[model samples]
Target: MTVAVATIGFTKTTAENFFARLKAAKVKRVIDVRLHNTSQLAGFAKADDLAYFLKTINGMDYVPEPILAPTEELMKFFKTDKGDWDVFSRDFSALMKERKVEKALKPSFLDGACLLCSEATAHRCHRRLVVEYLNKEWSGALTVAHL
Candidate 1:
């Protein structure tokens, strides 16, 4: 089964606690879907840096798949009649079909996969949309958890 996991809160999650939760979950990789990857958070600013820390420090694989990133076009669309969700959902599904996220996720999904972004609650983040798209469109089995 393909599982998509994501963190709920961003600013509140400490790197230590985040890593600890990931270890406990036995998550093999973390797929970051932030449109802008740079974060004020010290450890999660860069993809490479986060990946390194995930692997070297937490022993979990890290993969950045921006296809899941919410773009301006997506944001603009989402602001309208919830039509943006349709557009974003379509584009995201297309990206997955193209194997873009799958390709980037290659080694990571061998065990299990989780998506990450900077929101304290999945319901409050675009990552929620991505997770929904994955679970519904791709029929990917998913569970969202916070750390």
Candidate 2:
């Protein structure tokens, strides 16, 4: 079975559209990769709220996987540097390697799992780096579909 990788940011989507998109994508679970999931800024995407909605509305499991997130300090540095993706990706990639996420990652969990964050797009999200790193580490077997 192909292990799919999908990325989504809840900020740009409504609760209805968010669940609909996951359902449309046939996602079985959502692995939240945010460092701070309960921030008031998250609004509907707050950890508890998001989990409740995913389970009740979409019949999907919600998992908080902080290992896939960049360190708060790193994020601060990135924002301090004015949203430099190059620096962010470089440091975040190194962090994943140090954390041995590949060894910890359960391929079965990713069969229909989507990575969740707050960025509107994967272009600048560390979740994208995580997906790419896993793809490379696992010999490119993963099919990444950013939602």
Candidate 3:
């Protein structure tokens, strides 16, 4: 059976809406793919706060998977320098390949999981790339939905 995974960003969502979405999706685990999750800008989505909320709200387990996140250099260039996405994608893809992220994340952790980042959309975030890369590397064993 194909493992189903969902992706989400917290920028445009409130605490209520965020947990509601996760509950509705029946996400059993939340994988945080953010390199930095403690920023004040994250507010309710802060690492500690989100973990607590997920457990209280949906009995979901929170797992921080930083290996799936882009390198600090790539993030700075993309987020601060307004770098090209294609370039970032290429560079980050190479990094993922080098790191062998597919082998690092356990199949059990990915099953019924939601990948969390802060972009508000999966369109141009590393979280999206991570899922896409995994889908390809895993021989389409993963089904992904951006929420």
On TM-score, the leading prediction is 3
lDDT score, candidate 2: 0.86
**Weakest 10 consecutive residues, lDDT, candidate 2?**
79-88
Q: Which lDDT tens digits does candidate 2 get at residues 1-147? A: 568768898776677887888999999999999998896655779889888889898899999998988897898888766867787788889999999999998677788899998888888888889889998888887899999
Judge candidate 1 against the unseen true structure and give its global Cα lDDT, from 0 to 1. 0.64
- State the lDDT of candidate 1 residue by residue for 1-147, as single tens digits: 655465534467677777777788777778787876777665564677888888898788777776767666655666444664556666656655665554444332533666787766675567776666555544566655655
Q: How many clashes show up per model?
A: 8, 0, 0
Higher-TM-score candidate among 1 and 3?
A: 3
For all predicted structures, in order, the TM-scores are: 0.68, 0.94, 0.96
Candidate 1 regions with alpha-carbon error over 4 angstroms: 1-9, 73-111
Error of 2 at 18 (Å): 1.1
Is 2 or 3 the stronger prediction by TM-score?
3
State which candidate has the highest lDDT: 3
lDDT of 3 by residue, 65-130 (tens): 889988889999998999999999999999999999889875657889999999988999999999
Model 1 misses residue 44 by how many Å? 3.7
